[model samples]
Target chain A: MIPPRFHGVALAAGSAAGAVALAILGLWCAGFAPLAVITTWCAGAFGNGTRIALSLQEAGPLLLTGLATALAFRCGVLNVGGEGQFLAGAALFTAAALVLPVVGFALPLALGLGAAAGAAWAAIAAGLARWRGVPVVLSTILLNIIAVAVLGALVEGPLRDPATTAPQSALVADVFHLPVLVAGTRLHLGIVLAFVLAGVVWLVHERTSLGFEAKVIGLNPAAALRVGMPVAARQMQLLVASGAIAGLAGAAQVAGVTHFLSAATTSYGYAGIVVALLGRLHPVGIAAAALFMGLLDTGGRACEKQLGVPHELGDVVKGVMVLGVLIAAAWAARRSAAAHQGPADG
Target chain B: MAELVSGVAQSALTAAVPLLLAGTGELVAERAGVLNIGLEGLILAGCIGGFAGAVLGGTAGGLWLGVGGAVVAGMLVAGIFAVAVVYARVDQIVAGMAVNLLAFGAAGTIWHALQDAGRDSLPSGAGFDRIALGGPIVFDQYGLGWLALALVAVTGWMLAKTRAGLVLRALGEAPEACAVAGIDVLRWRFAAVLACGALAGLAGAYLSIMRTHSFAPDMSGGLGFLVLALVIFGRWRIGGLVVGCLGFGLIDAVQQQLQGAGAAGAVSYRLFQALPYLAALFALAVFRGRGNGPAQLGRPWPEER
Candidate 1:
C-alpha cells in the first residue's frame, strides 16, 4: 500500500497531468499543432535569458499576492479583496508620490503607506464581518468594485499624467523606482524581495508559535474560542496582514514594472487567488506555483505572438488547474480520512 | 427637468429588471445555503449563447431562441458548480472563483475569435420594443421588464408561503436534521443552483438581446456581484431585493446621465459610477437587524454518520 503522503502527492501529480492533457486537447481541437504550441510556450517562458527575466517579472507581484492569500487562507479567513487591496495600495502610493519629496527613503515610506491603505481597506470588510454579520466574501467583492471606481476617479482627476493622453498616473521619480538586479534583463529588486518575503513567510508559518495558534484557529474556530483564544481578533489580524501583503504587491508593480498607476494592474490580484490555491497554502509551494503561473503568463503572450492563440487561453488553463487542485486535495483528504478508520471498523 | 426625471426613471426601471431577475434567483440559492460566486461567469456564458442564438435565429424567432439558449448555458455552468460544491464538497468560495475565471477567459477568447472570424459588430437585432405608456407614471419599458416584475411577485410568494420553500430553507439551516427527515439536501441544493443559473442566464439575455442589443466581453461588468450585494441588502426577501435593485438601477442611470450631460466635468464620472457599490458596503456596515443568511450558509455538510 502507498504511504499516505505519497498517495496525496501522486493524486496531485495526476490531477496536474490531467489538466495539462485537457489543455493540450483543447489546443489540438482548435486546429493548432499541439507539440509546436507547447514548444513555443516553453521557449517563451524559459528558453532564454530574456524569457526567464520576463517570467520572473510576471511572478514578482504574483508571489507577494499569493503569499497574501495563502496567509489569510491559513488563518481560515478568505480575503477575496486582494484586488481591492492592491488597488488601494497603488492608489495610495501614487497619492504619496504626488505629495512627498521624491528623494532619500521616500519610496519605502510611500510603499508602507500603500500597504497601510490596503490593510485599512481590508479592515472595513473585516470590521463589518465581525460586528454586523456581513460575510467577508460579499463585502470584499463590493470593496473591489468600489476600489476600482475610486482608483479610476483618482487617476483621471488628481493623479492624471498631464504629459500623456492615456489614462494613467504621472510617473514617480527615477530614484523611487526599484533598481534592476540583473543587467540586460528587466529583473528588478522586487523579485529578490519576493523570494526573501517567501522565506520569511515560510519561517513564520512553520517555525513560530503564532503560526501554531493560527493553525488551530483555522482548523476549528469554535474549539479555539472554547480554549480561550481570540478567534475574531486573530481573523481580523490575518485579514489585515493579508491585505498589506497584497498592497505591497501593488507597490512592487508600480516600483518595478509599470512605474505608473493604471487599470492594467488589476488582473494580478485575481490571478494570485488562483496561485495561492495551486500552491496548497504553503509559502515554498507558493513560490514555485507563482513561477509556474508566471511562465504561463509569458507563454500565453508568446502563443498570441507566434501561434495566433489568444493569450486568454493561459488564464483558462490556470482556472482549470485551480479546479483540478481543489478536486485532488478533496479526494486526498477523503482518502486519508477513510484510511484512518479501517473497513472492519465500519 | 420633468422630462429628465421621467427619462431617468425609465432607464432606471430598464436597468433594474436584469438585477431583479438575477438577484431574485440568487436569493433562492442563498436561501438553500449555496453562495454562488460563479453567478458572474454563468451570466457571461449566457451572454455569448444568447447573442449567438439571436444572430442565428434572426427576426422571426430570435429573441425566444436567444433566451432559451441562455437558460441552457447558464444551467450547464451551474451544473458543474453544483457537482463540485454539493457532491464533492469543495470549498464554495474557491469553486466559485474558479468558475468565474474560467468563464471570463473562455468568453473573452471566444469573443475575440468571433471578431477574428468577421462577425465584428453585427447590427443590433430587433430587440424588445418599448410598450406605449400614456404618461410618466406608466413604465414605457420592454416586455422583459414586466416579466421580471411578475417573476419577483412569484418568487416572493413561493419563498414566503410554500412547503417546498420551507423544506429548502430547512435544508440550509440544518442539513443533518433534514437528511434525517429523509430529504435529499444535495439534490435540492443542486436544483437551487440550476434555477439560479437559469435566471442569471435570462438576465444576461436581457442585457444583450433586450437591453444593449449586442454582446461584449465581460459586459456583465461585475453586475453579478452587484446582484449578490442586492441579495444581502434586501435581506433575502423579494420585496427588499426589488427595492435594492431599483435603488442601484437609479444610481447607475443617474451616473450615465451625468456622463451624457457632461456635467461630471472635473468630478470624475467613476466616482458616480462607483456610488452603488460604495453604498452597498456602507449599508452593510450601518444596517443592524437580523442577518438574512441561513445558519449553515457556507459550511460544508458534515460527514455521513
Candidate 2:
C-alpha cells in the first residue's frame, strides 16, 4: 500500500501531469507545436528574476482569494462572490486612499477599510441566505453582476478622474503604494504579506477549534446541528471572514499593482476558485496552486508576445488543471471505497 | 407616445429571446436533477462557433448555419461537463465553473486567431430580417424572437403532458427509485444536460446573429446566470419562468431607453445597466424559500453495479 504521505504527492503529481497533457492537446488542436509551446511557457514564467517576480506578483492576489474560497468551502458555504467581494474591497480601498490623508498608517487604514467593505458585501449575501432563504450560490453570482456595475458607475461618475477622460479613478497617492520588496523587480511587500497570511490561515484551520467546527459543519450540517453546533451562525461568520480575505486581495492589488480603481481589473476572485480546488482546499495547497496559476498568467503573456499564442491560454491551462484534479480525486475516492469493501467480502 | 411604448415593448421582447431560450433549457436540466452553472461558458462557446459558422457559410444562408454551429459547440462543451459530473461524480458546481473558465479561454483564443486571420467581420446579411405582422410591435419581431416564444410554449406543454417529461422529472425527484425500476438515471441526465446545452447554444447564436449581428468576448455577460435566477424566481414552472424573463427583459429595455435619453444626468449609464441585475436580486429575495426545485437537484447519482 502507498504510504498516506506519499499518496497526496502522487495524486498532485498525477493531476499536474494530466493537466499538462490536456493543455498541450488543446494547444496542438489550435495548431501549435506542443513541445515548443511548453518550453516557451516555462522560460516566460521563470527564466529570469523579472519574470519570476512578475509571476509571484500575480500570485499574491490569487493567494488571498484562494484562501477566501478555501475557507468558505471548508465551511460548506460556496462563496462564489469572491469576485464581487474583491471589487468591493478595491473600490473601498480606493475611496479610503482618496479621502485619508497620507500618514504613516494610511496604507493599513485603507486596507482595513477595504476588508471591512468586503466583509459587509459578503454579509449581505449571508444574511439573505440566513433570513431570506436565498441560496449563497445564486445570490453571490447576482451580487457579482451588481458589483461590476457599481464599480463601473463609480469609476465613470463619482470616482472619475477629472484630470483624465478615462473611466477610472485618480492615481492613488504614492505614499499608499506597497513598498517594493526587491530592487529592480516588480516584487512588493503585498506578496510577502500574502505568503505570511497563508501561513496564518493554515495555522487557524489546522490548529484551531473554530476551523474544526467549520469543517464538521461542512462535512455534514445535520450531524453538526445535532451536536448543538451553531450551523447557521458559524456559516455566516465564515462566509463574512472569507469575504474579508478576498477584499484584502483586492486592496493589495490596488496598493501593489493597479494603483487606481478601473473597470478592467484582473479577475483574481474567479481564478481563486480554481486555485482553492486545485490546492485541495488546504491553505498550503492553495498557496502552491496560486503560484502555479501566477506562473500560467505570466507564461501566457510571454506566449502571447513571443509565440503569437493568446494570453488566455493560461486560463485554459488552469481550467484543465482543476478539472484534472477533480477527476483524479473522484477516481481515488472510488478506488479506496472499493478496496475497503473488498476486505469485508473476503 | 404610442410609437415609443410599442418600441419599448418590441425591444423588451427582443431582449428576452436569449434569456427565454437559455432559461427554458436550464429549467429542463434542473428538472432532471442537474444544475449547470456553466451556462455562461456554453453560451460563449456558441458565440464563437456561431460567428465562425456565419463567416464560413457566407451571406446567403450563413445565419442558419451559424445557429447549427452554435448548438454543436455548446453541446461539445456540455459533453465535457456531463462526463465529469455524470460519469465521474465530481462536484457539479465546481466542475461547472471550470467549464466556464475553459470555454472563456478557448473562445478568446479562437477569436484572437480568427481576427488575426482577417475573418473577424460577419457577413452583411447574417442577421435575421424582421417579420412584420402589421399590428403590435411584438408582432413585427425577428424570426428568432418568435421562435423563442414558440419554444417556450412547446417546452411548457411537453413538460406538463409528455411521458418523457414525466420520466425526466421523476429522475430528478427520485433517481434511486427510477434505477430500481430499471431506468437509466445517468443516461437521462446526460441527455437532459445536452439538450440544455443545445438550447443555450441557440440562445448564444441569437445574441450574435440576430440580436447584435456581431460577437464580442464574453458577450453573453451575466445573462446566463440571470437565466438560472429566473428559473428559481419562476418557482421552476414554465409560466413563472416566462413572467420572470419578460419582467427582467422589460427592466432591461427601460434601462436602455433611460441610457439613450441620458435623462439621469451626472449618473453614469452603468447604473442603468445594473438595473436588471438589481431587480433579479430583489426578485430572488422576494421569492426566496419558495423554491420548487427537483428533490434531488445537484446531488450526484452513483450507478449501482
Best by lDDT, which number? Answer: 2
Top of the candidates by TM-score: 2
- Per-residue lDDT of candidate 2, residues B182-264 (tens digit): 88999999999999999899898888877787889879888888888899999888999999899888998888888888666
Misplaced by over 4 Å in model 1 are A1-3, A6-12, A344-346, B122-125, B128-138, B288-291, B302-305
How high is the DockQ of candidate 1? 0.71
Scoring the B chain of model 2 against the true B chain gives a TM-score of 0.96
Model 1 per-residue lDDT tens digits across residues A221-290? 9899999988889888999999999898888778777788975545788888988888888887788889
**Per-candidate TM-score against the hidden true structure:** 0.95, 0.97
Candidate 2, residue A337: Cα displacement in angstroms equals 1.3
The global C-alpha lDDT for each of the candidates, from Candidate 1 onward, is: 0.83, 0.88
Fraction of native Cα contacts kept in each candidate? 0.73, 0.83
- lDDT tens per residue, model 1, B1-305: 88899899999998898899889878888888998899998888788777777766667777787788888878888888888888888988889999899888877777777777776443343555677777664378987788889988988888889988898788778888988989989899999999998988888888877787778876888889888878877877788888899998898888889888887886788787787788777777776366457878766776533
Clash count of each predicted structure: 0, 0
